[model samples]
Target: MTTRAGDRSDGTTVWATPAWRERATAWADDELAAQGVRRTGAVEQPHLRPWSTVLRLPTSAGSVWLKAPGPGLASEVGLYPVLARWAPEHVLVPYAVDAERRWLLLPDGGEVLGRRLTPEAADRWHLALAGYARLQQRVSRAADLLVAAGAPDHRPQRLTALLEEVADDAAAVTVTDEEREVVARARRERGRVEELAGVLADDGTPPTVQHDDLHRDNVFAHGPRVFDWGDAVVAHPYASLLVALRDTAAPYGVGLEDPRVLAARDAYLAPYGGPTAATLRVVEAARTVGILSRTASWLRALAPLPPHEAADVREAPYRWLAMLADGESL
Candidate 1:
């Protein structure tokens, strides 16, 4: 059975029910016990974007975050180990796994940095991003070995697929002629991104794993542990950077024009770097397409929304669309 948080009608989140949680908890206990730890209690923390449930379990040794993918759990199992092996220098170590329970036990890192997303936080984020860039360089090489060994391609195809699906529904969501025009423009831009993907796929190089969703909540400060590798994929080098740029820009109110966004992007691509401008453009286009598509999908799924909620939903995509339309970098 599905255990839901928030409004079920909205389809934002739902997870395994009491029995499922109990089974998962029992499995977690076993996993932790193997690691010389014991679970004392658990607290729930809800994440909004790509909604999921995080359980904070106190252990005899310390606390660890038990992230159970509401619906995306299997994806986590597939990607986390690969990331653990490839980007060891950049991400948090995954300590234990309960494959049947669809849960991952990560040492509870400290609070997330940039709670407020200020310029100072941006700089620190930039430094952290540089570390990710270095990690990506190593992972890119590792991806080749995995591919030769016959592993699946880990590109951001989900984003690509999501965009195409959303673009088709744009007309229903677009209430005005002007809005329709904007939707048309977005569709055209997405086409460019698709073309770029085809070009990349045709090239001889292997795809690198990317954290398709790289928002602040996924990253931890003090500990510098990047968690939630469920969205990892083997894609073009710039795919991860693009997601990071959009994530960092949104929190800080930094537009695409913000030098820090570009600087961070540059820093990320500096090592084992490919075509900076070209790759960024493709990723940027992809990001826009992804946002547009997701927004459209959410709007469609929750249609005839309550007036207040509908207004909020309607304004969400346009806000980002306006930012992009203004030719801002983010």
Candidate 2:
């Protein structure tokens, strides 16, 4: 039970600080002694961008990824066990080297899927999405089990609350007239999409688990293995599809209308009960609202400003606000 530098009151260890590193090393040594696992030593890997810190630990069993959670640690921990049970076939299972320490060991077998998603890589994308679809089916089944256990349904409501907060701040944020228009439209569209949740839930459609945060970075594809399961949620099945579409559009340079995009979406949904065209549209709209709200906050905090980048950080909230107000989808 050796403690690390960034060890919180709850005993979760933060791997970023020197004290935590010492503690982590000590804990690893102890765990190895208990489990008969041989340690190779700590290998420093470059940290991933966009926040949080991760390190690669070399061990005799295999390489393990040590991720330090920021504010969302508890939420991620709560979600992982559920995903492990529900989507065991599709996700990488996290081995808890130290639960109290918040030290996670994941098999380092997968390559990032984004790297393989080239225009010529249509088949790979299709395979990836198909696997994703199967994962969603399991998630839906898990959601039902959670509901039966009286777990609070937080997915739909969280997005709704975030949008409302964005709307409240939209009026005060300064932005160009064009960006204002975008924000206004987004606000209105968000309202319309929010209203459809009840309809979607009540229409006798089975709920599937969703990876609410399904960015390209979250997915890794090595040979046939996909990793990272921290953000899985039991909610709308199409949520991941929307994430794929959104991510593919920008950094991946894949357009929404691209044949591969459409094909991948279809392949992902084909095995599960297929969602109607309208349902897909609603999911896409809902996801856009969520993204805009997040982007607004990020822009405000990071200050991605004028003279560089497409739009100013200060303007993002307004643009999203205007888009929502006008009922437009990104």
Candidate 3:
């Protein structure tokens, strides 16, 4: 059945090639039949979403989504239930979590929201940002439990260390005297940068659920249902804005100056006095350092890079460090 991955069929079955794909599908079929539904069609989304296998299955009853996440993502399984308790409609409600097999049968999440803008798109975009903020606020109240459940800590404790590390890392690379001086200035000015992030959802403030990746495809068009919590972190929620701003701005073909884009920013910042130049700076700083964090994570996942080529592999992230040292906004 696994002739190829992301295969589509009008027939009553869907196949994917996750390590657990076959076992997960058989379990899904058994579970569906127990509910008196029979599978009729299936298709896999072509995109690789972290480490899970996503499938769309048509059944006698309705569409069912199969997500068999890898071991590292067990936290996401529990997060769905947590969201259900926090905000009922905020995320898709999984019908069941086969904890032992590490899969979930969920109601189909609809298409990605607004690939192109419509007049109505602006309103939805605003609402999605506001909704994201509210979700973060709610999760902030439960930060301890979430961290216990394995959400990451990207607060000032982490950021302060990151700044120091970036400075050290950049120094290891060749830099001009001016850039070195700039890095020294950054170290001295680190307190203010920490204060900015700390005042948000970082260490000093209540930690919130920050969705580090919010590309349009990760969000659904119908209810704007957000999926793929694999990279969710309990960090400064402003970090989420970095990804949001880039993805949101791209489709509108306008910079942050545009009214619609500004509205979206305002909506996201409504609880924090709306968007301002200062807030933009915080957003930029958080994501700029985040570039290194993300790079390190990706490298770790693809770990044990040949020692000889390791330095070459690290050049891009070192360059990001150089940018951070120069105080250049990402």
Alpha carbon deviation, residue 236, candidate 1 (Å): 1.5
Q: Taking the tens digit of each residue's C-alpha lDDT, what string does model 3 give over 21-65?
A: 556667888888887878887645443333345666788767888
Query: Which residue pairs collide in model 1, if any?
Result: 154-233, 154-234, 155-234, 256-329, 256-330
Candidate 3 TM-score versus the reference? 0.71
Model 2 poorest ten-residue lDDT run: 1-10
lDDT of 1 by residue, 1-330 (tens): 122224232212234355545665677788888888887766444433333456667888777777765332245654666667877656667777665545677776677765455667776676666666666667777775544432334344544564444455555567777777766666666655566556556543445755556666777776465766654545665556656877667765778668766776776656646445665556554454444333532444234233443455565555545444444454
Which digits, one per residue and each the tens of the lDDT, describe model 2 over residues 1-330?
112123334222233467776665666556554666666876674663322456777788877666654332333545556666777666677665444544555557556666454665556666767777776666676785654432224355456665555554554443556765555555566556567555445445466555555655666654333455434444555656646666656655767877656776676667765657765755564455445434433433323222232233445446445544654544
Residue 305 Cα positional deviation in candidate 2, in Å, after optimal superposition = 19
Error of 1 at 187 (Å): 5.4
Name the regions of candidate 1 deviating beyond 4 angstroms. 1-17, 41-50, 115-120, 141-191, 198-206, 273-330
lDDT of each: 0.57, 0.54, 0.62
What are the clash counts of all predictions, listed in order? 5, 37, 3
Ranking by lDDT: 3, 1, 2
